[model samples]
Target: MKYINKKIIFTFLLVLLMNGCLGIIPNKDSVTRKDTTTNIESSIYKKYNRHTDTTYYSHNNLFGKNISIYWTKKKKEKSYARIKFSYLGSRWIFFNEVTLVNAAGSRISFHIKSTDISTNVVSDRIVSEKANFLLSKVDIISLKKLFNSPSVDLRLSGKSHKDYALSESEIKSLFEILSYNP
Candidate 1:
């Protein structure tokens, strides 16, 4: 009987691993400063088993500031690219000052019509912008040559004074993070 119970437990663990039932949940805290994840939405993370590999890149024009970016997929129907900007001195992601150009040569502007914003002070007030603009697939054939190469120049242009671009490594990491199925 004891042997049978042990086997059952092993089987259960295997199933959980295979189905991705064991994953860190994505939440506001997941992308926040390097501490205090108390505000995380554990229920959603428990339900979906999201992979919590967040990518960080330094912000342009903001000294000593880095932006945290992460990807999330809900019910396999909605995919999101969340970008958070914060600084200790004085800098924030002004909605009108940011623009994103995808690999398809499409220039998309940030829409402030409706979004969920939460304020908490850990390192600084993080301005999070979760957009579904990256939900669909894009033509990455043009990026094959630039794969994992951090020699390309990417600049952000719009109504914002800040400046930053995805390094080659960052672009590769972005692709890897978004390649998730769930």
Candidate 2:
């Protein structure tokens, strides 16, 4: 009978100790992860993956160099273009000049801009080059001119950079989908 009483006391104390410890332990799921990869000054890690189900565009022998592009809208609610390219010992913009020409002969140039997105890099290779070029709603509406024109052209050119062109067919195929993905 005495042995049974001691066992009961020990069990009660153990249970009480465990309950106290539970309150002191931190819960990982309750904590949110801070985003540090995005928003860097003059760094490749500034590009982050903002899109889901990315679509790729590439052409061989585009001015004697391989030119490629990946675009989508997922993480970034803003209208942006991320270019993963190699030119002039740089891993950012592949072309020095980019323009959109409408049938009315209106030529709109795209100025490369910095973004808060981040891309991981290791050693000397860019693992991910996700540069975000924000496109505002007003800007997209203006693009309607190029889309509705009889002939739309996406002309890209640069020194040491790959010069490439996207036909009307290519622009139409991606514009509607990439521009509006809610």
Candidate 3:
């Protein structure tokens, strides 16, 4: 009886070990086929001149206060691009200029100035502008990378300027705008 019981226990342990090993070894045939399908899709998207749409937002801590900025691709032209963006909150009062530029030396810029009431002390103005191809690609991933990259020496009256990462939703909206062929 003892020998029989031992045999049964040993068989159960062997079965359990085999099941565990099977779980760890992935079915290579299925994984390889799935990867092949994804590669083909990616290649197709690239071949068709398909541009993705994206939106990006960023924030900064300036003078102990938070200032938020956003950029979105609004439209595209045969030889140019159009983008819309906003500087949120009270800090908007300080901003004085905004611009967008491309490689062909085309530029579009906007400016504003706040009039001081009491002390007659005007703040160091705020300016926002897009330069280089980076501004043209305003998707979430690219925007995040842009903020992380080196500064482009954008300043307003000696005040340093910087960009921050945008939210996921903002990136999606920007992509939508860019993807519209019209």
Candidate 1 has which clashing residue pairs, if any? 25-45
Off by over 4 Å in 3: 1-80, 92-163
Q: What tens digits encode model 3's per-residue C-alpha lDDT throughout 32-113? A: 2113233222211111223644433221111111112333332352322333333322132343544433223333343433
Q: TM-score of each candidate? A: 0.35, 0.38, 0.24
Worst ten-residue run, lDDT, model 3? 58-67
lDDT of 1 by residue, 15-87 (tens): 4543234533333323222221332222112223536443222212112222333445545255554454432
Among the numbered candidates, top TM-score falls to: 2
TM-score of candidate 2 to 2 decimals:
0.38
Instruction: Tell me the deviation in Å of residue 119 in model 1.
Output: 5.1
Measured by C-alpha RMSD in angstroms, how accurate is candidate 2? Answer: 22.8
Ranking by lDDT: 2, 1, 3
Which structure among the candidates has the greatest lDDT?
A: 2
lDDT of 3 at 151: 27
User: How much is the lDDT of residue 84 in candidate 1?
Assistant: 43
Instruction: Give candidate 3's whole-model lDDT.
Output: 0.30
